[model samples]
Target: MNTSGGAAAAGRAGNSDALEHLARVGLIALGIVHLLIAWLALQLAWGGGSGSADQSGAMATLAEQPLGKPLLWVLTVGLLALAVWQLAELTRKVPGLRSTGEERKKAVTGTVKTVAKVVVYVFLAITAFRFASGGGQSSSGQEQQTVAGVFAWPGGRFLVGIAALVLIGVGVYHVHKGVTKRFMKEIDAAQTSAGERRTIERLGQVGYPAKGVALAVVGGLLGWAAVTFDAAKASGLDGALRTLLEAPFGKALLTLVALGIAAFGVFAFFRARYPERT
Candidate 1:
């Protein structure tokens, strides 16, 4: 009749090979989204047409495909599964993590990232569901509207500033992960052949920084909006990329970023194939 023991048993029961497989499918869905985003970014670089280059944009692109609705359903299922897997990790213990100083710090950091992953997967999954159910719409400039909504709340400016800092911090961590090759730990290095490992490493080195830099820019804009009391300035990912396109030498830079995003998408496929870290 021990409630805690029963809860622990239930948590363990949620861990299964089927769940892991579904999680891998989520990674695949993630890769597809990123690849589509990359393609959208490239279009922005070359044509500068008015289109969203964020997750919503990616989902929109999927909706236009021949089997788009079905694909969206698949993507939704995969992302939801991945989110569940990551959420379950919140209550589970790391295999080798101990209660020591460095180990403890690593544990905390890993938990934070896992939580971020869960949020990301759930968001993407919900977006997919919306599109699948014919409720999706173009998300351009919604970030500004969302921020404006927050501005109506009491002390909302402070919350926006804090959110900006979190985005920047996560962005920096991604850059650090890429530059230090720490992203390798996110996968099973032992499972791949030498060539495959090298390919993944190369992809991570480029991809993580590209993603990190983009997130940092988004955060920087949010921070600016908080300071100016102008929600229009905080346009989120779509705006950040568009801002780059408006800058001097921006086309070249955006193209590089787009390529890097594509690299990340490819790396995600390999991650799906391995998924040991998941």
Candidate 2:
């Protein structure tokens, strides 16, 4: 028996536990970010101050508060932990992956979801770090620049179109999850009260579709960018919300969506409180 192997296993277990703890805290940080974004979006909806309503903008707002820098550091660490946790989940084998066809399909879908989360969390972690270090930029500007760079490449339009389609699919999935109360699968129902379940369900019903609408608009903008060969049309979340203002009864729509987003942020707090261990 190699004592060294046992020591390494113990070390790995300790690290995993630390990462799990961080991931739990990260969920709370994520909720705070969403709540900030919701506030900015509401300001726009109600004809108030001018501020970008996106993740980067949220980070910037956080930076303006007391102890903001230290908070950024904590957010950065938490997000990084979340990214690592998702990556680990993505790579881990699914239970009964080889047992049945339905199980195999579920495993594949779960893997894809985990992979997407890993990408999102990593991007968010980078954004958090940038704000923490006082080196943040407008998310809208960054999106346009990235789209422009993509267009400069050969066959870029088609690639952008494909990306738009992917976004739409993701949006639809969120809507479906919300409408179907599928998100409850991630909650430890056995540990929750009936009232809590009802509250979560109600929140999911409103919040998920709101997120879906936002993503759908973002995808549409990307599609416009692809079709017109104009990278400027491909804006981020802030751009999407502004575009909403250009339509009929836009303010009302934006306000509704903003409320839904705020609800999602509140739901995220519930998630932090009642996470389902894998």
Candidate 3:
């Protein structure tokens, strides 16, 4: 009767299951949002669209549809579940991995990344909740207001510059992850069929770089804003997409990007089916 091994086994088997299920549902919600964003981008690419080209626009679109509010509520729950999953991962361990020096370094890195994700997921959840509860406000306006506030703070420009660099770094990481197929680490390949793995791989390879490109442009906008002290330059994802649309060959470029984002959305479905195990 070895209690220690039994406890570890049970811990591995039981506690995270509900979290994992909720996280998968959250993945679906994420997929839907990205897909909606892509659709809006496409609309903007051609001629006209109703919503802005970002998450808020996506949520607003969702809110306008049949049973939209209920769906928003579901998404809110899902996103919060994802945030909780990230929080749990802050202390969760792979059952067999030892705490070696290298592993410890990896753990530290994972913790930092997890913390970032938790913030994102929580923010997204709040946004979804607002939309569901009819308290929704303008995401772009909120960003602008926040930027304006930061400008008033002492050494605010410096802080803004630092933020710009962080966004750029994250953008680069997303690109690297996609190009290198490093995202495979997050999926349990054993659970997927061979064709599914290939399909997922292709989707990620396209999706990540597209998403990365958008984020990098966003960071550049922030950097520009910081240097010129123009809060308007710091407009987020919606602004980023619109900026691309204005570039030469912009229509074609934006179309491709929209498709790439759609790829990411599709990839999320696969991810929901086969989640991260380690």
Best candidate (score: lDDT):
1
TM-score of each candidate?
Answer: 0.93, 0.91, 0.91
Task: Indicate the residue-level lDDT of 134 in model 1.
Answer: 91
Which lDDT tens digits does candidate 1 get at residues 99-183?
7787778788878888888888999999999999999988877889999999999999999999999999989998998999988
> Model 2's lDDT to the true fold?
0.85
Identify the candidate with maximal TM-score. Answer: 1
Q: Residue 208 lDDT in model 1?
A: 95
Give, for candidate 1, the lowest lDDT window spanning 10 residues. 89-98
Instruction: List runs of model 2 lying over 4 Å from the truth.
Output: 1-16, 94-100
